[model samples]
Target chain A: MSSRVEILNDGGYRSDGRRQYELRDIDIDLSQQGTADGCCTITHGLTQVLVTVFGPKEAKMRSQTLHDRAVINVEMNVLPFSTGERRRRARADRRILELAATIKSTFEPVVQTTLYPRSQIDIFVQVLQQDGGLLHACINATTLALISAGIPMTDFVCAVSGGVHSTSPLLDLTTLEENDLPHMTVAVMPRTGKVTLVALETRLHVDRFADIFRLAGDAGQALHKEMKRAVKSRATRLVGAMETGMKPPMGGADAFERDVVMEDKMSF
Target chain B: MISFASFPVPSQNETQGMTRHHPDVEDDIDMDEGFEEGFHRLTSPGEPLTSSQAFMRGHGTYIDNDEVISSVAGTVERVNKLISVRAVRSRYNPEVGDLVVGRITEVQPRRWKVDANSRQDAVLMLSSVNLPGGVQRRKLESDELQMRTFFEEGDLLVAEVQAFFADGAMSLHTRSLRYGKLRNGQLVTVPPALIRRLKSHFLSLPCGVDLILGLNGYIWASKHVKQSEQEGEEAFDAEAVYSNKNDDIDDATRLAISRVSNIIRILAAHFIPLTDTLLLDAYEWAVEQEGDVKDLLQADIGDAMIATIAARD
Candidate 1:
């Protein structure tokens, strides 16, 4: 084995010091981004992705509209500096297109697109930083963005990546671990424990597949808890804001300033 | 299964009191009860709201298995036995008779497509608009060729939702004098939820600015036109109404317009619903600060303005 660093240490900790079943720390920001109906910036460890959702509004292209349902158009852009290599990928890059396609398909069954006919829901995913688990971050962020935008969906789709390092399975593998291990990303709708997507690029033993899949699904449930809390708090804050002066000013100025600063940062 | 009967219902007198106040006050009371009974409980997608057998699902909800699962992240509301979730943020859902400000996107054969921030671009049929000479003028073939003169693509106008087509697309009409061709104005977009239906959607401020509060969240702030100069049905001047030229605006009026627009933008950023009283107070606060119109956008000043307004309320 040409692996310079040990994937798992003697203490049963991975290179990032996480245990076999431990996932990366997740950070979610479901704030308004310009005119987007819903927007979310999610970070999993060092991987960061920003997803903005616009519409269920008029379809820009008449041909793309469906007579009985809304069409979802997913456009993804991976910033050249997102990865250590700093390579610029063309808009039509096959891998990027494939990832976008994967995201669109994953959300198709979850979002109740039938509610709005002859309209289009645009999901714009921007990969800000990438260490690993890029797909997981994108899918999770898109889910939150859709929810915040008030797009109806059957359930929240929580995604997490799992890998098999030798016989042991590791959750939320970093770039280094992902490069050297057989990993797969799983997206699950937490309500019914239904698996929406299972994307595997590397080969893994048949027996190991079931274990990682189940582990990823459980991790997705944990992710659902975090996402649900964020959405609930956001809804509560918005409802409170809409209630006008009925309640005392609760973080009104502070929150407004934060939003202004965030908008300024996004402009760059 | 949780029984909703145990929740305290508002008495008849309370409802009467609600009617006596502003219509929006009734909404506030309803929300308060929603909070108390947990009927307006915050729910996320996939959350099981209630048994399908007990309730009929409405918008933002779908029946899955035997339960009515919420399809959106919002507060779950129940009207009698029909349960629905009103999304906190979404595209404008237009209703009949709503005044909206829209920009023309396309001029079709007999209808003009308008970007009204709704699910679909609202259609403004030729028959729904007033002609140049008079209100009751017959449709002429020459007018068909000169549609661009009336409302070319990209012209902003104020209109009312006349009706809806079978596909849920709203049809708009600009037959009223106050409804056509916006000029000497600025359009500021905000979330539709922030605009409450008031006694009147039109307001003329003391600062020489007229405001049109579009229910679709499009606000038009322009130079106030005097009532005497406004054309009536008998003197409908199509040339002036459809004219692309902007009236010469003096510097002070321009300053006031920007200040009003900026104030509206700031209030919207804070997610505060725009009421004439609240806006008047905010404007007064802005004028007292005496900051530059651009400076009103600054974080500190904007925060102070919102703080002052909230305190006053």
Candidate 2:
């Protein structure tokens, strides 16, 4: 009501001209950043987040180490300019801490931390821009970063935000639509179709909750395909680069002998 | 050497030739079909590789519902019947006889916790090190008390991965004279996979720099120390090996060290593999520019250097 921009237009389209089930374009970049073991930058329309994963290595703090499993530490920083209105949030802000905790809990079961005993895996999520679906972008980026780091996991966790606008259910609400609607984020492990996380901050009717939750879960599976393709291509490129480097340098007699053997086998 | 001498090459070649001629041989069919050629197909987590009956689950893989599925996104590699996935980028997996450079994180009772960029802090026990004086010396209480004197917290050292502990943590040893506390240079960290196993990891560059390419991606670039001078008359001189002091370094050597270190940083940034020949070629190109060593870090210069190296190859 107070907002001049209509959340839903008369043509059954959102302010962004998207239909009820239309999701934004997703872009994923899984590239090494600095000293991080693995880093990924994901953009869901205007919302962008960069997640960097370090360790499964020595835990810097003795108190944080687990006896039989690795400790997961997630630190999130939301840049002041991330939102439409520039406002800086302190590192220990309650909302930021809550977001970090949500991510940590969501990944706790999926990451096979027991493989690394007494070590720590640090996930640093930096929000460069925020539109709507911020949590979804963060979770998806973290999943890719963890995989690129070679951390073992049960399956890929894909997340999506869904909301119910009046009588109709919407998928991937933007910031404007999110502020006006009752929305929730759902994360699913696509391999088993099991929901890992369902975070809802706003109140919604019992009847509407089921529709949005189910829609978000299905949208997550679609997002999973896109993420899987990105991860697979990245892995392939890296393995190819490594093999090219591993090729025995030319002029070595050892390589010549191997080539001779290959020729002999091929001739037969 | 003796094993090779025992097996005559002519007979081995004849058997290999015969095996190659037989297409019906199921055992050798893999080689004939060229399945071993090229890189293994890559697999993502949750993607099934094969049935559980035919393949054994290895690292980076798991079994679910009688199917061997990959647990990590990586290339699928099979050693006979044991199938595993080798992650493209991962923490260093230390093996026996691997040279590694690590910073001492904590000096415990008789062991030093070294951060070797591995999953866990590598352990350097008092018994594994060659204390000053003699190579074979019994452990002493005083030695235990003065463990920090040998390797204090934050000190970096080059050592060999001697063995593994029960928990799979690596145990490093500085028993040899060549392996000891590092000084007079800087350390450059890169992806461990970039370092290829070679005949000799210790290289004394012609430009007055000594390079120790640790398989763990902790490369030590330092002022060249003559091999004979380092050994000295006393092979186990604790004073020299355990000394915290850095010797006087000339300005030229200092410049060369920075140049080499910068070249390594650029190469690693581009995800290029580091090899002696490739590095030497890069250094030569960098020097040819006659520009400041720091200039090599610039985008244009770095791109040119990698291009020249790739062209030469």
Top-TM-score structure, candidate number: 1
Instruction: Please write out the lDDT profile of model 2 over residues B1-313, one tens digit for every residue.
Output: 0001101122456435443233246335433332353447777887777899987889998888888888889888888888888887889999999999999999898899999999999999999988877876788999999898899999999999999987779999988777889998989888898898765577667787888899999999999876557665356677777788899999999999999999888777766788766777888888899999878877777878877877876
Q: Which stretches of model 1 miss by more than 4 angstroms?
A: A245-268, B1-39
Clash pairs, model 2 backbone: none
**Candidate 1 chain B TM?**
0.87
List DockQ, one per candidate, in order: 0.28, 0.24
Question: Quick one: best lDDT, which candidate?
Answer: 1
TM-score of each: 0.90, 0.88
RMSD of each: 11.1, 11.0
DockQ versus reference, model 2: 0.24
- lDDT at A52 for candidate 2? 93
lDDT of 1 by residue, B93-118 (tens): 99999999999999999889999999
Give me the displacement of residue A175 in model 2, in angstroms. 1.2
Model 1's CAPRI class is acceptable
Query: How many pairs of residues collide in each model?
Result: 0, 0
